[model samples]
Target: MSNLTARLRASLVAALPPEQLLPDSQPEYVRSYVYVFGATTLASFGFLIISGIVLALFGPGWWHVSRIGHFFNSIHFWSVQAFFFFMVLHLWAQFFMAAWRGGRGITWLTGAVTFVVSLGAAFTGYLSQQNFDSQWIAVQGKDAMNAIGIGAYFNLLNFGQMYTYHVFLLPVAVAALTTVHLLQVRRRGVVPPIPPRGLGG
Candidate 1:
């Protein structure tokens, strides 16, 4: 364990350098509205995770019955909504910037996959709510899932299973995927935009 930790630490130090990792200096060209959107989107995801944890710990049904639980539930719901909102904006920005152009194609693709998985996670979460909306979505979504044969493995009508998935399984998968995606981003570095053709003087 100690050796692994030392090796990991060494690798990070080699890749990032002390100054860049804890940044006393930044590139002048890094200034742009585009940069802010990435940070904002990340912050929204952080909010969602924190709020979701609170809801999970309190128990989803507890919120409907208890005052504090209800408040946390509200926060969780708002956080989810905020997360989706920022994610959409972030994706649009990346698309407009043509961010997939360089070796950063992996980063772009990984992010796209993560976004798709996040949408699934979000949908399953809503279905697990066990409310009127939950019932409606379950009955509606089951047809699509059944048609695709995923319903065999994932039963939307089983509240117990759906709840477990939303609280534990789905989040774990998202966390794993996000970890890999972030590692790819850090390794590849951010992609620079393509220069115009025939611009040389």
Candidate 2:
């Protein structure tokens, strides 16, 4: 047992050194507004998760009928909006900075995957709302989903199924992908700014 534990520790250390896992400092270039957007995106996601949990605890129908529930619903709604807003800024900033330059392809890939999954989560949330908007979206989305042959397993018209997806499965996927993306970011450290070009020789 001791030998197995030692081997496991060694492997973990080899993959993620203490310095990389918990850095005390970062490069000076990391202070820029562009770099901050990534952190902002993460903060927004955290808030969205908290607000979503509150809504889930009270049940979906409460949000439509109770004053407190309505307030939490608004919070969840705006948090989703903020999450996407910050995420888009982060994506654009990383693209311009060429974040995948330092053999960080997996990091970029995970972030992109998280964004795509989050969109699916947002769509399911809309479907689970049990409101007129949800009805319209489901009616319209069914055609598109059918064209892709995915409507059979994923029925957008089913509120219970959509609620389960929005509150459980999709959130789990987004959280897992975000965790992996952050781990890769820590492993690689922040990407450096492009150096200024020299005057023509």
Best of the candidates, TM-score: 2
lDDT of 1 by residue, 133-198 (tens): 999999999999999999999898998888888878877777788777766656656556568788
Candidate 2, residues 51-149, lDDT tens digits: the string is 888988988899899999999889988889989999999999999989998788999999999999999999999998889999999999999999999
Model 2 / residue 8 / CA error / Å? 2.4
TM-score of predicted structure 2: 0.94
Q: In model 1, where do residues sit more than 4 Å from their true spots?
A: 1-24
Model 2: runs farther than 4 Å from truth? Answer: 195-201
TM-score of each: 0.86, 0.94
Residue 51 of model 2, lDDT score: 86
